[model samples]
Target chain A: MSLADLHFFKMTREPSLDALCAVVAERHAQGLATILYAGGTDWMVEQEMRAPLHDEPPLVVDIGRMGELRGISLAGDSLRIGAGTTYLELERSAVVQARAPMLVRMAKDVGAVQIQARGTLGGNLATASPAADGVAALAAYDATIVVKSARGERRIAMADLQTGYKKSTRAADEIIVAVELAPPPEGSPWYWRKVGARRAQAISKVALAGVAVVENGTATRFGVGMVSVAPVTARMATTRALVLGKALAEITAEEIDHAVDQDVTPIDDVRSTGEYRSHVARALTRDLLRQLGARV
Target chain B: MKISLTLNGAPRELDSAPLVRLLDALRGPLGLTGTKEGCGEGECGSCTVLLDGDPVNACLVPIGQCEGRAITTVEGLGEMAHLSPLQRCFIDEGGAQCGICTPGMLISAEALLRRVPDPDEPTIREALAGNLCRCTGYQRIVESVRRAAELLREGAAR
Candidate 1:
């Protein structure tokens, strides 16, 4: 099996989102493996090319050329991020910055400048990496993954989108169209942090995003999302339940520890040990809670 | 698959595999070898090029996705007779050592200077973060971009 042996038979450029969905549906009906591609920045192609093809190669469609899925906008309190929006777009988008600054920070820290320029938000979601930075941040906002096929469109919560590592719940015939996020209530404190091998161009060993609303020195709302600590980007339900309605001074570090243990069930992997991830996850949760609690 | 794109300021119509990397396309059919390949992966930025005025890793970009977009490689910046300011600065400031990282660095710096003509040191460092230099210790590379910005501004003033 060599790169030369791999055959790329067709590369269709869909001019619009509807056109793309139709093509994907038709391809799936014909029993051809179809993959939606954007920016072409993923290393998956290189790996796919190196493997010998036993039968017909999968049809690669470049949906980046689709004009509809190319920018970020806010409409009626919902932030709509087009699927083909690049990380650079996410970083530069004033709408994303103002509404979800944590997402902008996460986008900037995803990779170095090149990756940020070429890698896309939809690609990250579709790839469904447990350590995907964008997903981790989106979870904090309770984002919905909007997907479409020729059959119809569907919106899945970010919490339910990922089934496992590198696997998504999206159907083969569906393409992610956009991510919808509702702006948090006024004056919510949000923080995002990822511990990786290096500052840039490193996959996360563990990452966490926290959003909380504090009023009258008491927590009104809390949302904690973490990655590389679990199989999916999970909302820290236990942590949120424990902290919500509690006075900032009343919430203790021990509470965060107990909630982190219940919220995230980490497994040892090559990038990090389960114990180290658990430790960092607890420490980060406590630190963010303390800081956010104080800022109220 | 066939693609028609603006390459180096010229309209180019070329034949290529849809999934073939723009890196291979440039080095293969397009006949522009100025762009180097270090990691082949996007991390190295050795194959960086400007896609519609944005810096992107050419090695990771499939040529099929580049249809109708304007691409600017290192060769497009300048030539032997008249080097771009960034190219000249690299030579004057000793930014190029083994020369592998030079093309990508210049492309990234060009993109930066296009947006921020006089960027601070942190801005310069951030723009060139994707392009790695094994020989110059990056201090000289940063200096080269800073110097290039000055040169470009000076040239514009005249």
Candidate 2:
């Protein structure tokens, strides 16, 4: 099959995880890669248009009908978000707004309202783009990705699952079922910021989500995600330590500056320069830290 | 796949690929050409339609997914002979210039009014965020929605 023979499959309703996994496994066994279709924003137009299938067109499996992979629920101390839930749903979801406001902020910045109305969180994770807004927020919250295949189900840390730039550990036969995030630590100040060329619909040059838990004038557990600056979105260990062990006021400017340099290893890309990204990361870290301090 | 939908108060059936966009199915198969395809992508809501009362980009929605759903296209809202309140307001308020974006603008406005009958400026702006009007700069379009709301309110009062 060639691009001319490319076919589209549409489901009446969202497909069950088992059904989706079966389809993937069947296609893989046939030596055919299945292009998981959701939202149809990035997939239907951009990628397919840019690179037409030369041999057998990948089987397009539509998962939009999978009702099981939709909705947000709070389970114990964690919040589980179905992979198929759109950004618009996340933004409007009361549970997400209350428990994970930063994720809501990330959803709002995913794309224009039209894109948000269709783009799903699972799509973002599956694409594994370094500049993905949801990835940054998920990293800050220590999110866990739930993968389901015909064999069974397994959970992987968001950081570990996202191995490299535009790459993930998700098996072809596994469909991302949901993402579970531990609730924000008590009394912790949360802040998220995205630096893009324009406000709406623009991809980020650098994005960051920071969570600071301050107790007795000292930081406890601090987490941050430096998006679009590395091979994959990651947390900064040195910066986390700097903010965690010491009071914001006592943390010297040099220490903060050094942490920023140590934490981020950016690359020169079309969106921004590595030096500029490093500079902004440092400035944003200090500003966010100060903002968190004021909140407490 | 054969998909059936109640479009604009009328029932219609289409034979198309399951992945065929609702915009294409409507325009090509069913011949409801009111909905324009500006971007083909969802970025431009030129193909906005009411999918089960919520306004969505028709281009992004596959035809198969809309099975047994109530779809309101621009043609269903009003016609040359009988205009809906929104269609009337758009004309009276000069909401359309080139008129290419008018159909989508009307459907989006209708969807908003169905949810919030009496909406303020911010609400109006946010509701119509998906629909883009390049000619009028949206000031007149916003005015048209307000006018339609007044008409709706007056009709209810009477």
Candidate 3:
């Protein structure tokens, strides 16, 4: 069949990972390549419409109906959010707001309300865009991703998931079912900031999300995500150390800037210049530190 | 795939791809032409529809997922014989200019009224944020929602 012969598919209710895998296997056995469709926001539609498809018609496996992949729950000290849950759902979730306000804030900044209502968390991670808002937030919390396939499930640290720009370690048969994050210890101040060309609906040039535990004028654990800097989102080790032992007020602007610059490897793109991204990353890091200091 | 659903209080079915967007299915298969396709993507809410009473961008929703769900399109809101209160308010208050964004605007307003019988300006703005109106600068759209809310309230009192 030609590309034009291909069409859209829908699965109203959530389906199991096994069901999805079985469907994919069936399509593959039929000698047709299958593309997984979830939310269909950015990747699938654009590629299908723009790219040349001279090969066999690609079958779409709609996994949006998988109910098992929706919801946010507290499992002991960790928080588990189902991959199917939309950004809007996370923004409105009281439990997420109370425990991880930074995540809630990130969800609100993703896209317009319409996009937020439909874009799934799994889609965000699977897209693996360097500028993805949720990925930066997940990185800050040192979150763990749960990937499930027909064989079983495996948990990988968030840092290990994104191997490169728009790349992930997920196997062809595995689907990310959920993300688990350890709750921040009490009294820790968490801060997230995203700087884009426009306030809403625009993708980020450089986004930063940081979680710091400051106790009695000393930083305990500091985690940050420098988005759109490298091929994948990453934590800056040097910056983490600078903020870890010193008080937020004690960190100098020069020290913060140096650490941030050391952490990121941004490239010049249509959205921003590499130098500009580096400059903003430094400025944002300083601003977040100052904000945390003021709050304390 | 053969999918069936109750659209705007009417039972309907169509033979289409399960992955086909509900937006395309509504316009192509079912021939409900009132719904406009603005972005073709979900960003623009011109293709908004009520799925199980909640407003969603039809472009992003797969037709197969809509099985057994009650969907309310712009045509379902009212008829030529009798317009829904929200539609009447939009007509009287000049909510529509070019009319491309009307269906989506009405569906969004309907959702807001269903949730909050009387929504404030901010609430109305938040509800309609997903919708983009190039002709009318949104002042009139917000006013129309306010008017619709009052009409619903008055109807409730009666």
Considering every candidate listed, which one attains the maximal TM-score? 1
Per-model chain B TM-scores are 0.98, 0.97, 0.97
lDDT per residue for candidate 2 within A167-203, as digits (tens), equals 8898877888899988775545788888988666678
Model 3: per-residue Cα lDDT at residue A93: 93
| Predicted complex 3: CAPRI docking category | acceptable
Q: Which candidate has the top score in lDDT? A: 1
Tens digit of per-residue lDDT, candidate 1, span B75-158: 999989999989998999999999999999999999999999999999998888888888889999999999999988998999
Candidate 2: which pairs clash?
A: A13-A65, A14-A65, A14-A66, A15-A66
lDDT at A74, model 1:
85
List residue ranges in candidate 2 displaced over 4 A. A1-15, A51-54, A185-188, A252-254, A267-270, A273-276, A294-296, B118-120, B150-158
lDDT of 3 by residue, A158-244 (tens): 878888779889876677899999878754688877888755666899988988777776777677887899889867778888888
Docking quality category of candidate 1 according to DockQ thresholds: medium
Candidate 2 lDDT by residue in tens digits, B119-151: 999888877777777888999999999999999
Candidate 3 global lDDT: 0.81
Among all windows of ten consecutive residues in candidate 3 chain B, which has the lowest summed lDDT? Answer: B36-45
